[model samples]
Target: MAHAFDGKVAAITGAASGIGLATTEALIAAGARVVLVDRDSKALDAVCARLGANAIPLVIDLLDPASCNTLLDGILSKAGQLDIFHANAGTYIGGDLSETTPETIDRMLNLNVNAVMKNVYTVMPHMIERGTGDIIVTSSVAGHSAIPWEPVYSASKWAMTCFVQTMRRQLNKKGIRVGSVSPGPVISALLADWPEENLRKAKESGSLIEPKEVADGIMFMLSRPRNVTIRDMVILPSNFDI
Candidate 1:
């Protein structure tokens, strides 16, 4: 099938690893110019090298607006226009509700939730001016519902999910599309702290999903016909209950 991403521009967050990295590869393969933003400088450099000239690496601390501005400027300098913004960066933290510290809440919210909302608010104006653009935000299955140990993560994802839903209608008249994707347990070192036995059990159970699966889903949506849009898609492993 013809790839719809040819000559497009994409901005991705938390892009140095996992789903973000996978999505970068997918976009590049589809012939898109991608701006990869993340705090991980080493990994970001490696990804850019692997992707050659099609990708740009920006070491950004999403908590800092200055960093984001540098990213926007870099993209404009390189691509001249922003076509798709993939807000796919985040971290995972696990703790019980009562055990969750304020620091943890703030950190996760700042990186996972705050970065997403800020990116949308910052990027959409640019899209609005263009008259045709798309935003793909990554939420977790955890965000759609809740897990016993992940209260704040759930709240943050839910907030992002709701914001996208609300913005879709507002942005529809401008011919911009807003879509959200939620993935179930994805493999990452982010899961390292979990007890070894339980992690092994979960892996044995085949509940975790691969980064490529989520990335392909993103590419599929981007390649859809101009008038087609998916409000949101939840991707849990077939064996998983979510």
Candidate 2:
């Protein structure tokens, strides 16, 4: 009669808002103690308050590798084990090929690529030591199918997708389940700042997807038995032909 996630510890990045926050909520509902990670203290505090003491907040600027190590150490020290590692934090900036700044592109890669690697390195040791765990990386549809002007974002996601897939092959033998969730066009903070008319047009054109829908897909993947490893999953709106 034990819940699937009972007694397990989940470490999630970007737990302050958007898809990351939603994923944290989903895991908690399934009975896992969570380490809520984000750069924003106030937002993290608000999320932790709502989730109760079972949730611990660790503020980390994903751009800094040392900070990542410290946060991971704290989680493993406090929780003793890391049952689930969710690399679910990312950023985006949209502009034409000529309009994008070098700074914007660099920022996107730093957040989406380097920080993801930090999470992997942080939790991998514990998983390897225990010989069992689940690792889920939040990739994007852009990983598989590139957009017209989203070069850095596409490259970063593709890197994540590839890393997780390769990891599945390498880590499976170690009794670790590694997978990735590639969500397409989710209507979340990912693009909340865009002009309403532009956003509406994309939705009206049938390209927009939902955060909860994606979160549900993640929960489904995580709910599977230990022997079941979903190498990669791509969730696109019905409108996406491919």
Candidate 3:
């Protein structure tokens, strides 16, 4: 039986854990060779080993402009052909913006917005040359709504929302599909700052989802027929509100 991703090559950033790792496992299960890109060498190596030969790990800090620019090129050289690119690497900064320092603001914006934009720009021509590819960026529910608690984080996602939608139109005729997976709070390290009581309450109230749920949403987006594009899929837990 042939799989949708058979013979395809995918490179996912922040692939060492959480949503990235879940998606990588999903893709590999579907027969795609995956390049796991992250800055943590130890975690990357562990995941690569656990996932076996199909999981290729590449360690690079997306925060650096030079590293971000060469991400796709490095993948192509290793994987030989790039068919899928998931820009899942990002950081979070919630709570009062007043307490957020300039450095913190810069880091969040750089990882969440700058790195994603640059990598997509870098990979476009290659995907264009092939005339086929899928570009999915991991966004947040905050991207579509004005979440006051995480104003700065929300702002970054809003930028991603605009970027993904506009890129979809721009690449429509070029045979490349651009989309975003916007997921509500999932159980991940990103929630480290959340108070333990709040986390417990959210989980008990069915307001939190697992990382695999988001990965499933991504799989749905990628598995759709090429002619059909799922521009944005907002995945949230059943009881999630506001």
Which candidate number has the best lDDT? Answer: 3
- What Cα-based lDDT does every candidate model obtain? 0.83, 0.83, 0.93
* Residue 85 miss distance in model 2 (angstroms): 0.4
Ten-residue stretch with the least lDDT total in model 2: 1-10
Clashes per candidate, residues 3 or more apart or on different chains: 0, 0, 0
Tens digits of per-residue lDDT for model 1 on 1-242?
33667888998988888888899888888888889988889988998998999889878888776786566666787778899999987877777778767888888888787778778888888889889998999988887787877778888888888988998989988979899999988887567756688678778999889999999888878778879988898999877875
Residue-pair clashes, model 2: 0
How many angstroms is residue 231 displaced in model 3 relative to the true structure, after the best TM-score fit?
0.2
**Per-residue lDDT of candidate 3, residues 24-48 (tens digit):** 9999999999999999999999999
In candidate 2, which residue ranges exceed 4 Å CA deviation?
193-195
Which residue pairs clash within candidate 1? none
Which pairs in model 3 have colliding backbones? none
Q: Against the hidden reference, what TM-scores do the models get? A: 0.94, 0.93, 0.98
